[model samples]
Target: MSTTEKSNEKRCERDGREKVDKFRRFLAQFCATTVENLLLFDMGLCHSFPFIIIAALTGFPNKHNLNETLSLTPIEASWLASIGYISEPIGSLLSALITDALGRKVAMMVVNIPLVVAWFLMYSASSVWQIFLAIVLLGLGAGLMESPIITYVGEISEPTFRGVMIAYTHFGYSLGAILVATLNIMMPWRMVGLVCMFTPIFTTIALCFVPETPLWLLSKNKTAQAEKALCWLRGWVPKESVAEELQSLQRYSERYKSCESCIKKDQKCIHPLPTLAEKLKELKRKQTLKPFSIVMALFCISVFSTTFSMSTYIVQILKAYNIPMEPDEAAAVLSYVNNLGNISFLCLIRFTGKRYLYLTILSILFLSAAVICGYGFMVLPIGYSSFPDLSPNFPLENSNLGYIPFVCIILSSFCIFCGINSMAWQMISEVFPYKTRGTATGLTAALSYVLSFIGAKTFYSLETTLSMPGVALFNCIIIAFGLILMYKILPETENRTLEDIEMHFSDNSKKLTDRKIPKLDLSQIGSAKNNSNMPTRPVSIKGIDEQNNKKSGIGCDNRSFVADS
Candidate 1:
């Protein structure tokens, strides 16, 4: 342990008097050097994918009067949309290849390459085909930013505040949305693209200055670099605590040889050091996928559904409602509400435990609200819908009910942020083995994007066929899947280590289902002074042989007492 880590750990454990100081210390360790360094969040990457495009383009490509404005054929607009989805996952997959190899700082900087070049291409575009070409480049670059950022952020953050630190990325997403909305109003479409061309440059600069992840360094067996990186991350924590953390890190180091020595000396599992790919293969072969994986899958499903089903088309739904203002004005208010929702949701997420119960509750509320709002718009056949008559100069005006869709939209987005977004990353970082984290994260991300493709394509087709209520009903169904998976599968993660989680899931499923399972008697457990008073037999292992003991005395009727734990 370094001097600072020791001091910090001592201060953290000094009874209840130093709690405030401990928190201050924790925050100091957690924050990055710049706003751009904080771009590693999945929310930022997801938001950036579409958000940057909106700011750069500054107008809807498929506006009803496309022929008059841009003289775009349906084919050109379709080309851009098609390229968006295709190129998105390309960058995402690229990030996985680069994350561990390049480190977070370099990865972030590297990702800006596609973004900058794409924007430069977009800025110079004078035709619809040229814009489509830019989108392909942009998607390739932005896709790399998506999954890798989540893994990088998770790698760098301290365990206690990791959840909150990751949640802050949603702020970046909100910022992108709000910034694009403003640009759409004040700037010419091409000028907007030109102005945004500088953003990636700024982002790239900040990323270059951030520290590499200590965990990744340790995993690579670079103990010295790991300690140095960790010190930068931990600020002025105590040396003892730092030492303890380092010792824990050393356990993961290939050079430690503890796992190997254990197998060789004690004739246990009998293994030596394995490559990362081998370790991941072992984890998969072991069927080490935890119950928590369900939580992750469900969250991704919800995010994927929200990504295209509501996020991109929400403003479309509002305009479809025939609101009182122009499409631009309607979008502005909706953007404000969406950002407000993100900020408030972030605050709420900090107070939430790892239990995704709140997520389930939010999903229910959002679905209910969506059903009411969408049903009102597309299902109920009210005359003029309390709106003004359609005309050449003036389109139909919206009812008060027109805004309710946004209300539902905002709250549902909050569910995305607090429920699915935070929980997915938190659980993935905590549950997956460090040896296999990179591969597992990469695999999960690829799966997520595949589903995102489904969501985007499904939402587009469904919206045209069924209208606004159909979209909500579709959302309601996806949210239902998330709620069910979360309720049954999410394990409590607060203050618990990954080992604890693994052990829980590794235990027999039937026994875990027992309503009145026994608890450990702390006083009787390893009490040297009262060793005589301790139970002579292990509670769950009576009459069971040590080898292949899954049945746990099921066939034995002797009821012989166990002698030790």
Candidate 2:
């Protein structure tokens, strides 16, 4: 071999090694966000597909020729649309237990089972009852999926990127809305349902490849598993690379575990498990309750802001009340604009401290727009009566104000998509501590859906009695009340870590000093000659600490523990 050939071969080998190392670095960086993003996106799709299917179905109510195929009455159709909202609370409760017990991955996969059944049921259904049942099933699936998705994503992502992850999920929902609206414009509703089924199935399949969250594994006392999970979530970094993160999570879980165990021992000197009341009391501590309270209020505001109401039934409401724009066209436009607006606003969430401003101002704007649009409906209908010579659809000829409702609808949609909808969901994901995250989020979600169900069920009836404009005016009042209440309370969570946020609640500024209870040696007391006539008080951890502290006259010194009876 020649010297020239040998030198050339060595250079080529060095170049190949450099390229491989570069690719490895890229893959490691990409995998961290990529796996989590995909999981969240899939769950987002699962949450939204049912809503998309129903929204598309409501876009047009013509018999079997388009979006609405079922021959059903107004009230019956309203029941069909509202059933999902009604069923979600039940699912939320179930998800809390499932996610806390079985792990987030299992809960995610379990939710898909019912979603598949619901979509499949709707695909072949012929009766109103059958369709209603399917919607109920889908609602259950949504309820079950909500807590785990938000909780799991929040636990898994870094603080710097958490808002973006949440925003992406919101974007996924808007994308689903846009896709279904666009597809229903060209395809049948049944086909949309069939297509929607693919999301949950694919989500389940994709989740199989991802590990459980490190926090969840840690909570289960599986330290080894938690380390491996952390490594995977960090993009296959060396186990040593994630050691700091793993230690932090373990410390958190251990602290929580310590706070949860009973300190009192029986005569046998063995510590028993904490009672149910003790657990509930622990959760009610200032750190947990404060955030939980704030989150619940925001959750209520998010729902009543007409986020779910307008998203699901804007098409039906407009078409039923004789609005000029095509319902499906309006939905598609609204979803497209919503996605764009959501993306734009989400970009600002991390950079700005204007979350409260954005929420309050935009929410009021949204509800007011709804009011004006509703009034347009009322005015347009009355315009027909005013002009005896013209038809109802000819309101544009009489006045240039005909475009007011469509403009208001667009304004309302822009406000909601741009601010409150995404903010509220992201806040819920950020607010709760890990110990009670599932329970608090689940309960708040259930309550949110309760408000949603009320709005959905009463929308048609409210329109019937008060006209569309009147209903909007009514919702405006309710939403304004909520926004005002929220403004006084909601905390800014942008670019903040989970621990940092909890510190605000757990910090020493509150001066909630623990009252020192001197542990009494009961055996020593039993043998004391001076306490022969004293009453023996049972030492239970319930309200015992308070009662004993108030009346037991217990006193202590450094050298020896003493109790005054």
Can you write out model 2's per-residue Cα lDDT over 1-565, one digit (the tens) per residue?
Answer: 8999999999899778556644443343345335444444443444444444555443344233454555655556567657788888999878887888899888888888888898888778887687778888888888887788778777776654566666666766677667666766777677767887777787777778777877888877799998887766655667775655565565555434443222112111134434545555656667677777766665566666554654555665555444566666777787788788777766766666435546655665655656575665656564222111122333345343545666676677766766766666777887676657788788778877887788767756665666555556665776777766666666666656675455445533332222111234434333322232222222332234233334433211000011111
The segments of candidate 1 whose C-alpha lies over 4 angstroms from its true place after superposition are 1-24, 33-79, 237-241, 254-280, 286-288, 291-296, 303-307, 368-370, 377-398, 502-565
Candidate 1 lDDT over residue span 200-240, tens digit each: 77776666555677667776677887766666566544454
Quote model 1's TM-score. Answer: 0.74
Give the winner by TM-score: 2
Model 2 score (lDDT):
0.61
Q: Which ten residues in a row have the lowest lDDT in candidate 1?
A: 555-564
- Name the 10 consecutive residues with the lowest summed lDDT in model 2: 556-565
Candidate number achieving the greatest lDDT relative to the actual structure: 2
The TM-scores of all predictions, comma-separated, are: 0.74, 0.76
lDDT of 2 at 418: 69
